[model samples]
Every structure is written in C-alpha cells, then in structure tokens.
Target: MPFLGLQRQLGIDLDSWLLRQSAAQPHGKAGACHAFEREWVECGHGLGQTRARRECQPEYEDFMECMHRTKLAARLKKILDQRDKMIKEGKYTPPDYQKSQEEPRP
Candidate 1:
C-alpha cells in the first residue's frame, strides 16, 4: 500500500459510526441492532451470495436510519447548547426559520 493508502486506516472505521453492536454501547436497548447485523451476515453467507448481492438490505437500512436519528439528535443538542451560550452572551439571535424548524415536534 502506498503512503496515501494509510490515510484510510488513520482512524476508526467509518462504519463504526453506525450503532455499535458491542457491549459498550449505552442503554439496554442499544444492543438490539446487533441482531440486524447477525441476520445480515447469515442471510448473505448461508445463501452463497454473500459477495454477489446485498441480502442485508433491510438490516442495513434500519441500522442507518437508527444511526442517523441518534446522530441528528446529538447534533441538535450541541447546536442548541451553542445557541444558549450565544444567547447568554447577547451576541447571537437565531433566525426565525431555524427556531421554527427546531421547535419540538409532537
């Protein structure tokens, strides 16, 4: 591998951003996604199309959706915290559009 190839190995795998199946994840419910991965691997390997087709489409999609939801919630929380800090400093006025969009949904 070339020096440039090492760039890909420099950090955690991008796939790890998805819900971790390991025991270290927070909350009892967090481990549920592990089942999806196991099913995906079994469906692919057992059918002998593991490399030729995506037998785990549903599992992959659901995992991604859950991952996105968690990431988005965290991002929103961070943004809100920043906004609060700015508000306290009297230096930032968040736009009405953002406020309206971010309002808690029912």
Candidate 2:
C-alpha cells in the first residue's frame, strides 16, 4: 500500500472535517478532558498505543464520535452523487419521493 493511504487509514489525515478548537478551553475546570487525551495529544513514538490516565474516557469518546461523523459524511456525499446521476438518467426512482435529493449538509 502507498504511504499516504496508510496515514489516512491510521486517522493521521489532517483533512478531517471536524476541526475541534480548544485553547485553554479543552481543559475543563477539572482538566479531565485534557488529562484523558494526553496520551494521544502528547504522543511522539506510540500514539494510541500508550496507556492514558484512567479518567480520560470522554476524550476517547469524542475522538471516536468525530471519526464516525467524518466517515458518515464522506460516504453520504459519494452515494448522493451516484443517486443524482441515476435520477438524471432515469435509472432509480422511489414512490412518492421528490424528483431529486437535497445536497448533503457539509
């Protein structure tokens, strides 16, 4: 496999749509979010292969949710494009459905 492809598969892609903004904000008053995500954020050699503080559950949950949303959006767009082409060519039609589907929200 190609090098760039592997980077993407590993979620190292910077092209992710969910660019979370955190200044001192990501670190809550209790600092749980920041502390939990330390292994990933401060990783140099073993990203996600290292153990994090036991309390960092929300950080991992947020990461996973973001990844899921990104993949869902990408797949939605691809399928929508295909469906539009089929509609134009009179290939597929659903009963009581509109002549076309709306654009997917980014």
Each prediction's Cα RMSD?
15.3, 15.0
- Across residues 31-82, which tens digit of lDDT does each residue of candidate 1 receive? 6667776555455554555552566677667666665677678899999899
Per-candidate Cα lDDT values, in order, are 0.63, 0.53
Q: Over the stretch 1-93, how does candidate 2's per-residue lDDT look in tens digits? A: 125478667766442222232333433543333443443444322333445434445566665545456767889999989988997899988
Supply candidate 1's per-residue lDDT for 83. 90
Residue 82 C-alpha lDDT in model 2 = 96
**Candidate 2 — what's its lDDT?**
0.53
Worst 10 residues of 2 by lDDT: 15-24
TM agreement with the true structure for every prediction: 0.32, 0.33
Per-residue lDDT, model 1, residue 93, is 85
What TM-score should be assigned to candidate 2?
A: 0.33
Cα lDDT, model 2, residue 18:
23
